[model samples]
Target: MKILITGGAGFLGLHLAKYFSEHFVGNKDFCSLLDIAEFDKKEYPKNCHFIKADIRNSTLMYQYIKSMDYVIHAAAALPLWKEKDIFDINVGGTKNILEASFKNKVKRVIYVSSTAVYGVPKKHPIYENDRRVGVGSYGQSKIEAENLCFSYIKKGLNVTIIRPKTFLGTHRLGVFEILFDWIHDGKKIPVVGSGNNRYQLLDVDDLVEAIYLFVVRSGHPQGVQRQQGHPKGDLIYNGAFNIGAEKFTTVKKDLEKVFIYASSERSESRSHNKNSSRQARTISKVFPTPAFFVKKALWLFEKLKLSPLYQWVYDTADKDSFVSVKRLTETLN
Candidate 1:
C-alpha cells in the first residue's frame, strides 16, 4: 500500500505524515509527502519520501499520483493569504488534485476541509446538510473545492470530505504561537468579547485518528452491507462529515485552564531555586474587550494591513461556533 499526502510541509500535513508512518511500516507500504515548500527530512520518519512539487502543477501531480493506494488532500491557502492566491491554491489546486487522483484510479482520497464553510452561521451545532455561507475568499474557496469533490464522487471516485474545526497540537504555530508567548510572558490576553462563547477546537491527534479510521475502515455503516436497491460507491463515507472536540467549555474557562497549568509548571521550577531573589511571575489574565469596538479596530487594522486576522475570525469570536460530530462518530463506529 502506497500513500501520498499533499501539502506535506504544513502543520496538519506533518502530523498526518507522522501518524500514517507508524501504521504503514510494511516493506512495500511507502508514504510520499508532496509540497511546494522544502521539507525537513529530520522531522519526518525514514519511511516517508519527500517530493518538492506543487499541487497546481497538473502534470507533476498526475505523475506523482500514479499507482497510489490513498491520497490525503490536506493542502489549502489559509485565510491570511491574498484573495487571489487563496482561490488559486484552494480552488484551482484542489481541481488539479482531484483530476489527477480520478484519472490515476486512486483507491481513496480524503479531503481535509474546514468548518469555515459554515461561515458564522446563525444556528448552533451546524449539520452536514447546513447551507454553506462562505465569509471570505478562504471559506468560499473551500466550498468551491468541496463542490469539486462532489462532482468527482459522482464520476465514481472514492472521496471522503472531513470538515474539521480549528485544530491545535504539538508544533502548531501562527496565532496559537502568539497566544502561547503572551501566556508565557504573563501578559494580559485580550479577547474580542466576554469570552463566553463555546468555541470548539480539535486536537491534531484526534483528527489524525479520524482520518485513519476513514482510510482503513469500510465506508458502509456497521451491519449494513450493500444489497438490492442500495446506493453504490461508498456513499456513506464519501459525504461530508464535521469533526470537533466532543467536550469543551467556554473560551474563558479554557484559557483559565491553560493559565493554571502554566502557573503550576512555573511553581515546580521555582521550588528548585528557593534562594533566588527574583519574585515569581504572575499568570496571564483574560481581558475581555467590547466586541463592537474591537471589531471596528480589527477592521481598520486589516484594511491597513497591520493585522493578520480576517472577518471570519473576529466576527465569530463572541458567537457560538460549533458543529455536530454525531454523523462522524456514528459512521465511524
Candidate 2:
C-alpha cells in the first residue's frame, strides 16, 4: 500500500510520517512525502520517498497522487502567512489535492483540518453539527477547504476530515516556541486574560493515532460497511470529526505545571554541581493581562509585522474553546 503525505516537512506531517512508517512495515507499503520545502532525510524513515513540490501546482499534485492507496492532505499556509497566501494554499491547494486524489481514485484521503473553523464560539464543547463561523484568514480558509471536501465526498471521493485542536509534540515551534523560550529565560509569560480558561490541547502522537484509526478502519473499497443510523452508502469515517485532549485543566494551571517542571529540572542539574551555589534560580510565572488591551496591542503588532500572534489566537485565548469528541470516540468504537 503506497501513501502520499502532503506538507511532508511540516510539524504534523513529520509526526504522521514517523507514525505511519512504524505501522507500514510491509515490503510494498511505503510513504511518499510531498512538500514545497526540502526534507531532512535524516528525520524520515528509509521506507519513505521525498518529493519537494508545491501543492498549489495542480499538475505536480496530479502526477504525485497517482496510484496512491491513501493521501493525507496535511499541507496548508499557517496563520502567520499573508492572507492571500493562506487562501491560495489552504483553499485552492486543497482543491488541487482533492481533484488529483479523486481522479486517481485513492482509497482514502485524510484531511488534517483545524478547530479554528468553529472560531470563538460562546458555546462550550462544540459539536460536529455546530455552526461554523471562521475568525481569520486561516480559519476561513479551513472552512472553505472543508466545504471542498464535503463536495468531493458527495461526488464519491472517500474523505475524512479531522478537526484537531492546537496539538503539540516534539519540535513543535510557532507560538509554543515563544512560550518555551520565555520559560527557559525565566521571563514572565503573559496570558491575554485571567489564565483560568480551559484551553484544551492534544498531543501530536494521540492525533496521529486517531488519524490512523480512520485510515485503516474506514472508507475501504472492499470492506465498506455503513453505520446503523448513517445513510446507505456513507461510510463511518468519511466525515468530519473533532478531536482533542481528553484531559486538561485551566490555562494558568497547565502553564504553571510546565514552569514547575522546568524549575525542578534546573534545580536537579544545579544540585549535581559541587561548585555551583545553592541559591534558587528565578522561575517563570504566568502574568495575566487585560484581554481587551492585549487584543488591541496584538492587532496593532500584527498590522506592523511585530508579532506572530494572530486574531484567532488572541480572540479565543481567554474563552472556553473545546470541542465534543463524542462523535469521534463513538464512531471509532
Global CA lDDT of candidate 2, please? 0.87
**Per-model TM against the reference:** 0.93, 0.93
- lDDT by residue for model 1 over 28-92, one digit each (tens)? 43888889988877888888888998888999989999978789999888787889999999999
| Pairs of residues at least 3 apart in sequence or in different chains that clash in candidate 1 | none
Question: For each predicted model, how many residue pairs clash, with residues at least 3 apart or on different chains?
Answer: 0, 0
The regions of model 2 sitting more than 4 angstroms off are 219-234, 274-280
lDDT of each: 0.87, 0.87
RMSD of 1: 2.8
